[model samples]
Target: MIPPAFRDPVHDSQSAFRRLLKALSRPGTPVSLTGPAQPPAPMGGPLAAIALTLADADCPIWLDPALSTEPVRRYLHFHTNAPQIADPKAAAIALIGDAGRLPGLNEFHPGEAAYPDRSTTLILQLPALTGGPSVRLSGPGIETTASLAPRGLPGWFWQAWHENAARYPLGVDIFLTDDRIVIGLPRSTKVEAP
Candidate 1:
């Protein structure tokens, strides 16, 4: 059977949305998401919560191969009414399950200078938020610097992220999630690998 989404659609979605915004505003800090029940396999609570909070009929979603299972697709479709697209660049939201084999950040749409908000928002479901080698993060929301140690990211991720951050308003924003927490990495954030 397909697992359920947020138990209380109205309240839960609203609460999740607030936490998502908090994550973004605090960049690199993990925020707790309390709403969603378990989604399908491989789709964790925080990732599912993000989809339920931000996706809608007008949103176009792209799922990486590892997360594009039939059950996951059906669950997202039934709850969000968001259409799934084959092209990552055309997606408003992209859910990535396997960070180790993630696509290059440049492959996704970096919204045009005229409308930066049109860029894709990525949700990466990682194995754990900690226990990996650390990278330094500093930018808008960060007072001085912060550390991120999300496991499973590709070796080239930090280099790619620097290039992404250099684009300013044109790059895609990302949310890193484990099972129950999410950390936002807006394009404005700077990531330095150690």
Candidate 2:
């Protein structure tokens, strides 16, 4: 059987949602998730916690092949009851297990002109939050600039991110996570090589 979800679903989900909001408001800053539910393999603490907090019956999810295992699927289904869709464009949130094999940013829905907020949000599982090549972040929420070094991403990630950012309101938001740490990179955040 799948492991139990948040001990206090109401309180835990509220707290987790607040943390995510803070992270997104302060791009590149780390946010720690607090909870007791340990998700199945390939789904780390932060990702699992995020799924529990944000996903629901209305939020359809798309899983990268590596994280599309039965256990992971079952766990999310049991806890969130969110539908898992095959088409990335139809997903409200996309969970990526291997950053190197991640699809292009434009491959997912960027939302339409009338409703840019409908774009998909990406949650990528990374090896670590630091010790890789740093990227300079600018734009909304940042006072001047911020630096981040999310390890395990492909070399072309920043270039792709640059392109994604150029789309202005029509772009996907990203959340990068290690085991327990989560860093947000909203569509408004600009990324550059440092």
Candidate 3:
């Protein structure tokens, strides 16, 4: 169902991008990513915001086996010319589903020692995210400190992140979106168990 808000003529795409940028620059800091009243079918405004901020012709995105078909594929193609690659190995951006289906950190491209920044970014749309185990993080862009309520992501996710962070600049960045909200976790942010 389309929300009433999208009808406004002033629905600005720039705002959505700015929010995403702040979050990317400051990992672990939750930012509210708003978008045009309605996004393409299936994917919500938040996910749409992510696509708008990140995807482009230069970026090769991998649509999950689930979303590789029509409308979603066409919508992304029309909106952002990001080519959809068949293999995750060659993809710069991976739009995935079912966090459980994601491969271990060692599996995806973690970039190389010379150009760790070459690693692919995985934009995984998950089932849901809520008060996760309380964990505090403090880093470059963070002020004194910050904490998340506690997410239900499985232990495997954390394990992978730990290993990924170990790779330093080589690790892939993750942008997680539920429906209306999107959260970013750059490689630099340290996640701890409370």
Candidate 4:
């Protein structure tokens, strides 16, 4: 059966949105989320909650191979009325189930200089938020610098992130999620590995 969406759609979505904003505003800091009632497989509560909170009829989503299952498709379509696009560049949001095998960050839309807000927002599902190689983050919203070690990302993830950040106001934003935690990595954040 298709799992339910938010219990109280209005309130739940509002709460989810607030948490998302908090995460993005303070990059690298983990935020808790009260996800959907019972999200489908491959998509745990945190990813499902972010999807529900951000995606809508006007936002087209791009699902990676791991999360492009029929059930996930149906659930998202039914609940959000958001269309799933095949081309990553055309999607407003990209849902990635496997961070270790993620496509090149540039494969997705990196908004043009004049319209940076049009860039894709990636929501990636990882095994855990820690236990991997740690990186230092410094940018707006951060007091000084924050350290993060999200497990399951590829070896070149940080390098790619640096490249993405170099583009200044023209790169994709990211939301990293595990079971119940989420952390944002806006393009403005600089990632340095030691």
Q: State which candidate has the highest TM-score.
A: 4
Show the colliding residue pairs in model 2. none
lDDT of 4 by residue, 58-174 (tens): 999999999999999999999999999999999999999999999999999999878999999999999999999999999999999999999999998999999999998999999
What TM-score quantifies how close candidate 4 is to the native fold? 0.98
Candidate 4: residue 164 Cα off by (Å): 0.5
Model 1, 34-93: lDDT tens digits are 646678988888889899889999999999999999999999999999999999999999
User: Which 10 successive residues of model 1 have the least lDDT summed?
Assistant: 33-42
Please say which candidate is ahead in TM-score: 2 or 4. Answer: 4
Better of 2 and 4 by lDDT: 4
Q: Rate the local accuracy (lDDT) of all candidates.
A: 0.92, 0.91, 0.69, 0.95
Which lDDT tens digits does candidate 3 get at residues 48-100?
A: 66775678899888776666658677777776778888878777888765555
Relative to the unseen true structure, what is the C-alpha lDDT of residue 120 in candidate 4, on a scale of 0 to 100? 98
Q: Model 1, stretches more than 4 Å misplaced?
A: none
In angstroms, give how far residue 30 of model 4 lies from its true place.
0.7
Which parts of model 4 have CA positions greater than 4 angstroms off? none
